[model samples]
Target: MTASYVFSVRFRLSPDAAVSVEPETFETTLYRPADPPGEDGWLFFRDNLWRGEVNDQRHARRLAEDALGVDVEAVEFRRFETDREHYDALKAAIADDLATFNADSVSEVLNKYFGSSVEVVS
Candidate 1:
């Protein structure tokens, strides 16, 4: 069975030359394969966050476990969403620190990647 949780990332961005000057809200979900213990999962964020590393997801997962003090197998990024474009970019950003998804440091990781744009809803 798949276990899930709510996670979000917040960040600022400059609008296009002709677009509005206000930064748009954006976010996404960091989905992992829940069946297997060590299988890599798909991260849904933005392009700015993607580092083109195959192990990026694994790294983030590890970080989450370290920071949260929770079992790596017990956590997953779930029910993700945003109010702007660049979905892939946001996912990439989260992937940078996938390993740190515990109760302690997951918030920090999200804040680092999304600034104030990330949030966790019950």
Candidate 2:
């Protein structure tokens, strides 16, 4: 069976900031065999909270820091093995958004779910 991994990063806003702000967290995911393919060989997902390809942990961390507008204290990542059942369920959950991207296949659906970016290895 092919293996797919989800990469996640957690970040907290700087405590010393001028404005009072609550800490927030964000995450991004990348799929193997990305739709339309990528030069680095992975698909990326960009969201309001986070952006970057899964394989490039540094890029993900930088994206989080940029969003938070503060230096991140720590970053964490987790990987999961996905199967058709899980993938289908995920597709179902985000079906409406996928349609917005005019996704015709699973890869297209995932590409839309994340965002447009070339995958790269660290």
Candidate 3:
């Protein structure tokens, strides 16, 4: 069972670095694996994402830059692609921590953090 978080990243050449065709900016898709909901590191989305996008843009940009080996000017979360097991597990986890989120239900919590960006795959 593999799951990943997708993000759209915009990158620009570092000004100090020499470039051949002149400094240019471009956008690319980035994927980061997601841990199981009950496992360590599962709170990554909660800490870094909100409302279907990257809640902390600067932090997300740095992460994207590190992963892509480019200077990321911006980063936006696209979605979380996972299997049904992961989605169910996430719901269970969210239910357990409902008080922490101050939400009345799992759906509300999911909306608050992930919005409509959760995609259950095969």
User: Highest TM-score, which number?
Assistant: 3
What ranking of all candidate models by lDDT puts the best one first?
3, 2, 1
Candidate achieving the largest lDDT: 3
lDDT of 2: 0.45
34-89: candidate 3 lDDT, tens digit per residue: 98887899889889999898998899998888888888889989999999988888
Q: Tens digits of per-residue lDDT for model 2 on 66-121? A: 75565554443343345555445455645535554466665665554444432233
Name the weakest run of 10 consecutive residues (lDDT summed) in model 3: 14-23
The TM-score obtained by model 2 is 0.29
Q: Candidate 1: TM-score? A: 0.24
Candidate 1 Cα outliers beyond 4 Å, as residue runs: 21-35, 38-122
Residues 1-122, candidate 1: write the lDDT tens digits.
23322433232345568877442533343443222222344333322232222225555546555654433432333343342332434445445556644323544555544445443333
Q: Give the higher-TM-score candidate: 2 or 3.
A: 3
What local lDDT score does residue 59 receive in model 1, on the 0 to 100 scale?
55
Which residue pairs in model 2 clash with each other? Answer: 45-114, 45-115, 46-114, 46-115
Report the Cα lDDT for candidate 1.
0.39
Better of 2 and 3 by lDDT: 3
